[model samples]
Target: MVVVGSGNSGAQIAQELSRTHTVTVAQGRPQPALPQRLLGRDIFDWLSALGLLEVKAASPLGRALQRRDPVIGTNLRHLSRTRQLRLAPRIVGTAGRALITQDGGRLETESVLWATGFRPNYRWLAVDVLTDQGQPMHDGGVTRVPGVFFVGLPWQRTRNSALLGGVGQDAERLIDHHLSSPGPRRTP
Candidate 1:
């Protein structure tokens, strides 16, 4: 099996498949990573305690520092160390039952899984709130178009905004901001 990407989804897929079948992971870039635990507590707990998770996404420094989403709570390092999973460069193209990699490596596999991330599809929205790249143009989930709030978006308020246990804080802030505003609320 060939897994494209090295993010959380890709790593998880490779790890699970390695237990049952030979697997190769094609990664284009170095995956950002964070330790699941630090100083006897979860990393999320430390971020919350230090208020790092509450940093505004609009801050220039914050945006500059958040280059990629760091994978957490995964055994990717272990899998790599154990030699159970083989790592290769990004796939350049496909040729009849085989994948050609950037490094000139060819992998013949019966199964190919693409674990790339998702892009938000807001084309159904009838508002000009999205950027040219199709991302919502907002300041901490508050878009220029009033009454349209986007929570749980990647880097919405912090690098943690899109994480499962982290989205709540962003959602809470958006709700608070919406309620405190002195304007007529428009239902979507």
Candidate 2:
């Protein structure tokens, strides 16, 4: 099997599939990964305790320090080191059942799994809420429009804002804003 992209999804899929089949992962660049736990505590706990998770996404220093999306909670490095998984360069194209890599490498496989991530598609929105780069213009998910909010957006508040386990804090903040704001309350 051939897996394209090496993010969390790709890495996890390759890891599981390799147990029953020969798997090759094609990645454009090296992925950043961190263990689930460090120093006898969950990494998320450390982030929360140190207040790193609350850093503003729009901070100039944060932008300067930003790199690649990190993959968490996986043993990808060990899998590669033990030869349980094979990693390769980016996939350029496919010919029949053969997958071609950027460096002229090819893999003949019966299945090709594409684990590339996605981007937000706001083209259907008629309002001018997007920036020139096609990203939403908002301060930590709250837009200029009254009562309008956004959540689960990458870097909405911090690096983990878009992660599944990370959206809760942002959601709670949005709920608080909604409840505290002056408005006409309609009782259901």
Candidate 3:
């Protein structure tokens, strides 16, 4: 099986399935662990620490941390390049076929898994707080998008809020603002 993307979710899923199948991870970046390390742990710890480690929203500094530290950025162990692992061009033209690259050769597979990660689907937002990529532009909980806010991500206003269990605080604050803020302004 082949897993596209290589984020935490994708890595976990790939590793889990690898025990039973010949799993391959197709990463856009040369390595996959960098993104994983952003959470602050080695692959062993990362995969096993699920729920045990605190997961949070991405804050300005946190997001910045991801850019600067990128813990797993250069580590490619998660993706073995040996015959066990192969580096192939990212699939584009179509998802109709499976492409493989190994020992300077190419082939195809019968099964594939696109674990390309999640793209925050914010299409339902009546308000604008997200970037073209659908990610919110905010520091802590303060949004550059005005009246808008974000929390529960990495560095969401507070350290704990980024933790999986801490998201409630961030949500509470945003909800409070939404409830207290005046209704939409009327046109002249």
Best candidate according to TM-score: 1
Per-candidate total of colliding backbone pairs: 0, 0, 13
lDDT of 2 by residue, 1-188 (tens): 88898898988898889888888888898867878899999978987797666667778755753666577676666787775688888999888888889999888888899999888887666777788878888887888766677899988888768878789989999878777878764435
What are the TM-scores, per candidate, against the unseen true structure? Answer: 0.86, 0.85, 0.55
Please write out the lDDT profile of model 1 over residues 8-69, one tens digit for every residue. 88887787888888888898886777778988999889888987776767787677657666
lDDT of 3 by residue, 78-101 (tens): 445533454454554343464644
74 Cα displacement, candidate 2 (Å): 2.4
The order of the candidates by TM-score, greatest first, is 1, 2, 3
Candidate 2 local lDDT, residue 33: 84
Provide the global lDDT of candidate 3 against the true structure. Answer: 0.57
lDDT of 2 at 89: 89
Question: Between the candidate structures 1 and 2, which one is better when assessed by lDDT?
Answer: 1
Per lDDT, what order, best first?
A: 1, 2, 3
lDDT values for all models: 0.82, 0.81, 0.57
> Alpha carbon lDDT of residue 90, candidate 3?
56
Give the lDDT of residue 167 in candidate 2.
Answer: 94
With candidate 1 superimposed using the best TM-score fit, by how many Å does residue 98's alpha carbon deviate from the native? Answer: 0.4
